[model samples]
Target: MCCNENFEERNKGEKITTTLDLTEISGMNFFDPHVHMTSRTTDDYQAMADAGIVALIEPAFWLGQPRTGIDSFIDYYSSLIGWERFRSSQFGIKHYCTIGLNSREANNEKLAEQVMEILPSFIFKEGVVGIGEIGFDDQTAAEEKYYRLQLELAKEAGLPVQIHTPHRDKKKGTQRSMDIAIEHGLDPKMIIVDHNNEETVKEVLDRGFWAAFTIYPFTKMGNERMVEVVKQYGPERIMINSAADWGISDPLAIPKTAVLMKRSGISLADIELVTYRNAISAFAQSGQIDEHDFIKIKDIDQSQKFASNSILRGGQQPRIDKNSIIIS
Candidate 1:
């Protein structure tokens, strides 16, 4: 029997289950390489912690619309370091962030320029592991300009970079993103060329850059395709992410994909490498990812306020166990 089936049978009794819930991954931990927890709810945080999400890396991304000012960028960066970090810790998850001028918003040359000046300040701050989710969106000149700038910031900080490849013209854009990072003298091993698919994975791996696949619901790669990439490429410098944000995304994408891979005959070591080990290795380059912080839950006071802002609509309890398996 496969690992998922074996674990499930041993834990849940010998019955074929059809759900894609967290019960399948009871004892395993996951590291979500990309997610926008700023837009997510406390319920999401509670669910993630319950699902064994020991750590996550949140990248500064473009909201559905463009941000207007530098103070907005400042506040956003502060939230990543301050509020978000505190919020995640309340549930026993280590929160890390990547600061950069994202590709879509890079089109606003004036605002992007101002944001660039402030990026260096935040990139080295605590909880920031890299300068990232920063690359081409439309493969435009402006996007390339800021992408190179952020690569320099990452290089200066001695940190790794998490690149966001263009959704359109992805192959050329992915290649160009890597080429520029190399041109800026950033080591290929220090860069993660994310959102890679079949067309781009070979070049990414061959160039010594890490290839990250986003296993989303309807766009980017799905779990089945991700499994194939791992099978063909053999999972050395490859990783998977949820990139779960303000859209239809799954925070459990990594663990769920790991479960699928196990059921499909991928080895446990291979599953662990892509879903967990690879991310920790890359993020550790920041010198801020503390293994001890992730090792144990800091004493969570269930009585304290959940977020500096409110986690409830009215005055709901902060400690709701969403995963209670009740069979009434």
Candidate 2:
């Protein structure tokens, strides 16, 4: 049977039920442009590697609750460039990150001031790709204050920007996000407007900013809708990401969406562009990414440790079974 074939068995005079298996699209390289790896596990890393994910970017985001101090932000940003980078590399995935004060957290006026003070120090770090996952959460004046500051920060650092559009009044927020970026004299081509939908995609693309869709299970963009988006947009500056985090989400959303795109008759080159290339081109403005280096799979030494932390525990050895049905 072909790998992409639906898994089903026929019964006399009965309808057959089938399940979509993601493994069908195995070996296709993917790069999740926006995900929260700090909220993921080692098993998630292994599954991503198995699905042929070559690289990913974990944007600094709210930690589900408000952090109390500027020192907390410092530690969190340190982990993104330190521990998280090492963890992803152990699974043969090159990890990159974007640092900024998330919009929700920006509402805290007291802490927001301190965060802005500390952001400049981290924004220029080695693994830092851009200033992002930044923009309006509730469209508050404080959020806008920090948002514009980070836009200036990106300009000073000569890095790209990632804008997080608001969930409520999305169309208005999406437009405002672009308007603000342009107002700051930042070029649209150097910005990535994320969490976009059908209503916002056209305007974002028309304005020349990259539009990134997050394919979540019950909310945001679904895989079926993504196929149609590709059909409508034709893949120029369009990209998809799992955006999986501590919430209810799937880490394999990129590869799974790629499978759905193929089943829907999207061409391989277009699939490659939206699922992988577009993200690289958008973020490579930081001059931190070299497509050739990241596209190649690095050697995985699961036994390797960073800061006294390894992917293994209890002296467990690494397992490499791609087809084994056994669950340990």
Candidate 3:
């Protein structure tokens, strides 16, 4: 009998069954190399912490709508490095960010020009990891112009880049995205080509770029397909992310994928590399990350404040019982 079958037979009369429990993957540290915490809430952070997510990098992307002025970009970038960082720390997860002009916003040439000027100011800030979420959205000339400019900025700043592949014509766009980065004379290892699928994965890995998969529900790559990708191609430069944002998405996708991958027979070591270590190794190029720091026990002190902002609300005290049934 199979291991699962044997276990089920042993517990025949009990309520136990062969179904895999997600908790089986607990206590394993995870680092989501790409996620948008600015669009998320405090509850997500707490859940991520509970799920073994040690650190995450939130790349700058379109905020579901276009902003009309340069000041909006400035304030948005400020919050990434300021309030967002503070909020994540309250939940004991380290938050790092990438600053860039997203492709959708880049089409506004008038505003894109001004936004480019200010990117330099935030790119080198503390906790800022790289230039990212900065590739083709609609594959327009304006998008290409800013994408190339940001690539140059990333090269100039000696930082890694996170490329967002176009959802439509993804295969062609993925190829072009790699070509441009190579044309700029940037090393493939320094670039992370994200939002990949079966068609784009082999080429990305073959080209020596870090291939990041966004496990989104009902769209993008699903968990079952992700397992097949791992089964076909061993985890080397491959990494998985939640890429959870303001839309309908699961913040715990990484941990949940870990569960599925485990059930699908992917080894623990391989799972760890794809879900955590690979992301750390890729972004550690920024020289900002210390893996040791993440491995330590990160204690959360709710009393801490940043710019007068706390995780608590309106003078409410911190709840001590996470499992309490009472809702106040």
Candidate 4:
């Protein structure tokens, strides 16, 4: 998710209002290509699986606060490919991630240079689907400097690029992101423009980039608005995501939005296109993922460990009940 200067940290004790009938889209497969699971709990993983999400792509994003040193970025990126991947598998979801210097962090030139150095070591590593959620935050010179560098990285590596359009001046940011990618000699088909809205969809599609909408509760596009976008655009290279993070976001948003798409008379073929197929078609260009990647993930051996650490604690048992709603 992109940074919003107006947003404040909320108290976790506060109640989150959600739609009542999220189960209507059950039994369908979803690929939320922009969720931040590091900030969510095991309970959210269980809920996403219960909602029919077979796999997801967690892109590198701002973590809601400034990370002080290069070690922090290194540790965070390591978790995305290591413990976080293992954790999602324990709960029956295929987790893949994009590796890059995020827009916000790129503004810090010295730290950004250090991050750029470490990126080559990780971008070509396993489970890295693309170089992304990378684009303008405030559209500063430093952001553009590293943005171009990562674009070169993705092209030379033969991986796709996931673009994060800005929260403010979204239309202009979305347009400029595509222009720059094109100018860099990257194919439009290789770019995934995210956080899109009505103001930017047509141009994104016309330019041949995959248009992705974030189904956030208030600040971004909502489920109702998403349905109309599909109705008008007809789901050609268009997909939707939750973008759930350490904010007032919903992890079960794709399923919930599919329910609305069904009730609104959107066809099942169209629904599956936007919710699942489009995501696979886009990121699979990296030759890093395929049909077998997300196939039937369940009944994992929870006894597994990452770097001598287990997802399980002292008295907690491994989860075997897929039908149950709670993770633990």
Tens digits of per-residue lDDT for model 3, 209-307: 999999987668899999999999999999999999987687899999999999999999999999999998899998888876564325334333345
Per-structure clash totals for the candidates: 0, 0, 0, 0
TM-score, predicted candidate 4 vs. hidden true structure: 0.88
Residue 172: error of model 4 in Å? 1.3
lDDT of 1 by residue, 1-328 (tens): 0012354455675666565576766898888989999989888887788777899999988877778988998998899999888888877788999988888889999998898888778877888889878888888889888887788778878999999987778898888888898899999888988999999999999999988989887668889989988998897999999898887688888888888998889998998899988988988878888777786544334334466755433233357544578633
Q: Which consecutive 10 residues in model 2 have the weakest lDDT in total?
A: 1-10
Q: Write the per-residue lDDT of candidate 2 for residues 51-106, one digit (tens) a residue.
A: 87889999999988889998999999999999888888767788999999999999
Q: Comparing 1 and 4 by TM-score, which wins? A: 4
- Badly placed stretches (over 4 Å) of model 1 are 1-20, 298-318, 321-328
Model 1 scores what on Cα lDDT? 0.83
Task: Report lDDT per candidate.
Answer: 0.83, 0.87, 0.88, 0.88
Q: Quick one: ranking by lDDT, best first?
A: 4, 3, 2, 1
Cα RMSD of predicted structure 2: 7.3
Instruction: Identify the leading candidate in terms of TM-score.
Output: 4
Candidates in descending TM-score order: 4, 3, 2, 1
- Per-residue lDDT value at 324 in model 1: 78
For candidate 1, the TM-score is 0.86
